[model samples]
Target: MGEHRDDLPLVLLIHGFPEYWWAWRNQIQTIADAGYEVAAIDQRGIAGSDKTPNSSDALTLAQDISAIARSLGASRIVVVGHGRGGQLAWAAPALAPGMVEGVLTFSAPHARAIQRPGTHLTLRTWRHVLTTFVPPLARRGLTDPVSLEHLLAEWSAPGNDGASSQAQIYAAAMRLPEAAGISLDQLRWSYTAVQRPTGRRYFELTKNAIEVPVWSVRGQLDPLLPERAWRQDHTFTTGNFRQITVANSGHFIPEEVPEESSQIILEFLHHVAHQA
Candidate 1:
């Protein structure tokens, strides 16, 4: 709605942890050009946003999206989330079905898929669990720019380390004491939520299949999230789910392939809008 006052639909973009609203910088204007109200907000505890331990929980994060949509005067919202943001995207529709129109996740899969036994928990997952249990080392690592650079290098497709280019910016943003603490909180909470015997937060999310159209996009070389786990998933309430893979891409699809990612998102939103 920056320049166009027409009743264009609303699309909320949520970035993953250790990143900020600027992470979606590539898609904001492009999506707006597609005739939709676009908002790229820094999720809680990330850069330029309020710090809160609640961002660690998926359901609560989803609630943030619903509340934002209401404020925008939209009855239903289209969501696009990446990495940890993608996890919240899935939970959003499940938590507030009547508020979400269609959902799109980038470089992330459903939390339910990852929690199942058949799912393969990669080294990256174990590393997150370890860091959560040990805080002193975590604080040091979180503060180090090299650590951030390393994550960007290791997570993306080979020969495409998106982290190196933005390491300076990210390091500066995460340097804030509150940002570091909130990140640590996410790791700790994620470990507890997954290891608990009866307090599984994702189970509550799965009780009802997401009652909206769902789309997933993954980086072909993202080691943290293997493709096998998503092969037979039918968790969408509408059962109208589709997955897209970008060639030679890693975990940070938007950063790595903005044009392709933006185009895909614009197309998906257009489809949803047409059906409405």
Candidate 2:
């Protein structure tokens, strides 16, 4: 969304489940105006992006982020994401260290942290994860405007004025052919892949601590991933790692608090630049 400059670092903004590039509508220009170039993409099967079913595993998804940065002529990149997208950002540095210089994630924990024994995922989160196992039902719920609206409202902080508008946009995008199904498939892989050989390989590859700087932000009121889920994330990074909890915010950190989120992101970007 901003001009690509040789001197300016490229920031790739990735949206999470039930969201696309529009999720970053508020922050795109803000980051660009701060002297950075940004690209907010519709990951894999969401929105207008190609629907590649059965190929949305962690490895493939992280590769997609690296591929996009290279295509954008970025020598080094900062990847920012929310929700599931944030999880991917956590893995990108390990999977593509040459391309990724830093990561800033909103409401996402490290992949290993989520998979550890006794991980603290809320009941609502488990319900959402289980729903993906039922393809037909999950697809329908994701595409239905009423259902989508309810889910967004349930996850967002109280008094969030943008929830309804965000739900409408995401619901419309899900109605695209195969979008809902593919989105569910991505979620399904996140859980079920651990049982497969490929998933084992992925974990092994990312087992070592990430070498790039990482900044993770989450809402104190986030129901899906509570404080316990993210507390150990600092252990996953060998480089600079910082975690911030925003009071009065929920799962939808970026949309719920765009101004504060942008400031946090810009702060991380400046930190990365200084370290480099």
Best by TM-score: 2
List per-prediction Cα lDDT, in the order shown: 0.75, 0.86
lDDT of 1 by residue, 1-276 (tens): 346535556899998866777778888998877667788977777676787646666556667888878877877688999987887887887667677888899977777666667646577867766876787777666667898777777777777756456876887888875887777776566556667533275666556776567889988877777777566456545657888988888888998888899999988887777767
Q: Alpha carbon lDDT of residue 159, candidate 1?
A: 74
Candidate 1's C-alpha runs over 4 A off are: 1-5, 53-55, 194-202
What root-mean-square deviation over C-alphas does model 1 reach?
Answer: 2.4
Candidate 2 structure quality by residue, lDDT tens digits, 1-276: 445456657999999988889989989998988779889998987889988754578778877998998898777899999999999898888888777889999999988888887858999999988888888888777788888888887898887755556777788899998888888878888887689777788888888898889999999989899999987898888899898999888898888888899899889998988988
The residue pairs found clashing in candidate 1 are 157-250, 210-237
Task: Tell me the TM-score of each prediction against the true structure.
Answer: 0.90, 0.95
The lDDT of model 1 is: 0.75
Task: For candidate 2, report its TM-score.
Answer: 0.95
